[model samples]
Target: MVDENQLRQWGTKVVDIEKQALENLYQYIDSSEFAQACQLILQCTGKVIVMGMGKSGHIGNKISATLASTGTPAFFVHPGEASHGDLGVLSENDIVLAISNSGEASEILTLIPVIKRMGLPLISVTGKPESSMAKLAQLHLCIEVPEEACPLGLAPTSSTTATLVMGDALAVALLQARGFTQDDFALSHPGGSLGRKLLLKVSDVMHKGDELPSVKHDICITEALYEISKKGLGMTAVVDSNNTLVGIFTDGDLRRVIDADVNLRTTSIADVMTQGCVTITENILAAEALKVMDTKSINGLVVINEQQQPVGALNMLDMVKAGVI
Candidate 1:
């Protein structure tokens, strides 16, 4: 068992080692032909195929996912498997991204002949630019680090970090080049919170039809209060002459009116309603509506159409039910 002090010291030392390794990676970023490789991937009409061996293969899997999610279509292929028969999955139109620390991984080396025969564009990411794999590729993205974070200096640690970062750099470059939007990302991640944040709209959650707590401007505050209770929205919109929304009344206003002894039975809702109430459009995103509610310090809002007519209404509870809160 290690003492607390020993654990803390070891943690600190590891952090420092990794930090220095990352700093050394910046030199490779500046000098490497990363730009040329990005240009090649952007020009490719087919998917990008990332190939590697062992530890590099694991990093390649994550890289492929990041690329596909961001904007580039990419997949991971094991170089060892490719040598047997999986090379058929790749095509001349696809761009191959090969990753290796020493730049001489044997499994990866075996794919060079097959890749050459297929006439596919090759991009190699390696620490040694002069290694056989790097020399064979048309573009080389150097991911060199001065040393590994592993104390033994044999394990792939800092080098893998640099390779992953380089993969991210390429993905983001392609994402920007393609003008990918938040909606595009949402489409790809529909099951996650990212999709919820981007795809959830006010209309998707807002209560519609008779579920809206609303009253005619001439109705007494007592009747409006009854509507708020029935709709359970904690608020009610006040509409006028042509059924166009004119004002709103909330639970906060009820407390104020009670102090002044305003007659809920006799007073028209317009007399106690809040004029110029904030409203949102049906097409607006629920997250944006939540922001508006936060900024205005209100819990409920009326949903309006493009013509400025109330179409629906909702409160914080509705947002919670729709998982937009």
Candidate 2:
């Protein structure tokens, strides 16, 4: 049986080791070689071709994805596959980013001569600066770590963490240099929740026309309650004779009326409604509207026009349905 305390200590030790590995990365990031790598990537006119072998390939794939998503076009290529005609993907304008912890992966080293023949710029990432791949590349970024976190010293642990962090540092530096924006990021990730939050607007999720729950300010409390129940938004906007917004009535107001023993049949909604309630414009982002709701401690909002006319209504449930909450 596994000892729980021993397993916990082992896991904690791995985390501590990786944490130190990341801290050691700061010195390399502050070096001139790091700036030169960023400048090379920034100046490249084509996609970044990232290549690696074994576990480094897995990390390389992730680094490539992050670079692509953050404005630097990049994709991972297996070093072994590149020798078998996959290298045809390369062009004169593209740059190669090679990753190997030891800087001596035979598969990658085998392709170095061919890469040199094509005159493509090569950037190598490795823990050993003196290794063949590092010495052969146009530039080398070191990710040296103190030691492997694996007790047996066979698994690539601290070194891999340092490599991944270095990749992130490069990607983020390029992202800032290119002035990448949230909208640009949303364009690349349109299918995710983050895309919905940044790109979706209040108009896309608001209920308008006949679907909007609204009642006249002079209407009786019972009639306003009926509007709220029929619309299923837990609240209704109170408008005047000209259809301009005056206030709002919600389930909370109904509860207050019940406690005061007010006559729902005779009381005008205007007398019991919440005046100057939270409102939003249709063009605002749904995420911004959520902020307004959260800041005001309310669950619903009335979308108004320049004339303060109730044009639409939305609630927390609507936000959830639209995946904005």
Candidate 3:
């Protein structure tokens, strides 16, 4: 039978070893070479072309993606493919970032001549500071780890983790240097939830025109209830004779009237409707609208124009459907 305690110990040991590896990474990050790399990327007008072999290639791909999304345009190019005519992608204005744990991947070394011929600055990321690839490059970012988390010292674990963290550090530092904002991030990820929360506006999700539930202030409670039911928004805007918003009546108001023993058939909505209720503009972000609803402890809001006319309406369900809740 498998020993459960042994398995737990092994897992804990791996985590501890990897943690130490990351701790060793701090010294490299504080080095002058790291600062030089950031400056090189910032000065380059072209994309960062990252190249690597095997496991390093996987980490390189993710690093490239992070750089691109964080405002530093970059993409990965396998060193093996570069030797097979993929080198055509290289431009004189581009910068090459090569990743190799040993800094001696033959595939990457083979492309050094062509990259040098193009006059592109090369940045190397490796565990060996004295290795050929590191010595050949204009700048080197060291990712040397004391030991591998793999018990056999063959599979890359701590090394890859350190490389990933280094790439993240570069991307974030550049992002801050460029003054990147949430709006800029939203532009790159418009389909994501954060994008929706930042970009979606009340006009994009609120029910407008005939879909809006509204009734005159003189309408009886029973009539207002029918409008609310027909609209399916659980509430109706109470408007004056000139079609300007006066108040709002909701299902909660109906319950209150019932508890008070009021005759819904005879009572006018204006008598029970909440006056000067919370309202929003169509141009405001849905996220901001959510904040307003939360602060007021309300479930819905009436959208009004400059003239105080009811233009649109939305509720918590609408916010949910819009992915803004």
Candidate 4:
């Protein structure tokens, strides 16, 4: 039977070793080769083609995904698959980032000739700087770790962690160089919640048309309450005869009006409504709308068109449902 103490000790030892490897990554990023790698990807007009084998190949796939999502166009191609007709994806203008711990994988070494003949720029990421693959490539990035966390020094452990960190450093550096914005990142990640929060517009999540809670400014408070209740937005827009927004009446205002003993049946909405209430444009991001509501200390907002007419309505609940909160 596996001993609990031994299991915990091994787990802790592996994590501690990997942590040290990550701490050592700062030195790798501080090197000139790191900067050159970023510049190469930034200036290249073609896509970044990443290649590797075995465990290095798995890390390369993640690196490719990170680069692609963060504004760099990149894709991973297995070296073995490259030999089996996938090499057609390579172009003369593209940059090749080859990953290998030993820097001498047979599949990768064999492709060096084809890559060179095509005149593509080669960037090598490896543990051995003096390896043939490093010497053959135009640039070499060292992901050398002091030791593998594996007890047998066989399994990829610290070396893979260092490589992954180095890949992130390259991706983030390129992202900053390209001036990539959150909106740009959202466009690439539309299915995720962060993408929804950043890209969802007020018009996309707001209640419009008949769903908007609105009433005439001269309507009695009792009539405005009906509109707010029917629309279910907790507030109603008070519009003038011309259909222009005049004020907003909310549940909070109603509470205050009742406390003051105002006659709801006789009072016009204009009497108790808040004039010049916080408003937003229909095209603004929902995240921006959240900020507006937060800073104004309100729970709802009126979305207005260019003519300043209430076109839509939304509350904190709408934002919450849309993942903008």
Best by TM-score: 3
| Candidate 1 Cα outliers beyond 4 Å, as residue runs | 80-86, 179-184, 191-194, 320-325
Give me the overall lDDT of model 1.
0.88
lDDT of 4 by residue, 1-325 (tens): 9999999999999999999888877787899999988898999999999999999999999999999999999999999999999999998789999999999999999999999999999999999999999999999999988889999999999999999999999999899999999989999999889899888999999999999998999989999999988988899999998899999999999999999999999999999999989999989999999999999899999999988899999999998898886
* Model 2, residue 185: C-alpha shift (Å): 3.5
- Give the Cα lDDT of each candidate: 0.88, 0.93, 0.95, 0.94
Could you estimate the TM-score for every candidate? 0.87, 0.87, 0.96, 0.90
Q: What is the lDDT of residue 39 in candidate 4?
A: 91
User: Model 4, residue 190: displacement in angstroms?
Assistant: 2.7
lDDT of 1 by residue, 1-325 (tens): 7799998987888778777877876766676477778888889999899998888999999999999999898999998788788888987699899999889999988888888888899999898989999999998888888788788899988888888988888888889989999999999998777788799888889899989877999989999999999999899988887768899999999999999999889999999999999999988899999999999999999987766678999898887777776
Off by over 4 Å in 2: 1-27, 191-193
Off by over 4 Å in 4: 1-6, 23-27, 257-264
Q: lDDT, candidate 1, residue 249?
A: 96
- For residues 211-321, write the lDDT of model 3, one tens digit per residue: 999999998999999999999999999999999999999998889999999998999999999999999999999999999989999999999999999999999999899
lDDT of 2 by residue, 1-325 (tens): 9999999999999999999988888888999999999999999999999999999999999999999999999999998899899999999899999999999999999988888998899999999999998899999999999889998988999998898889999999999999999999999998889999999999999999999999999989999988998998899999999999999999998999999999999999999999988899999999999999999899999999999999999988899989886
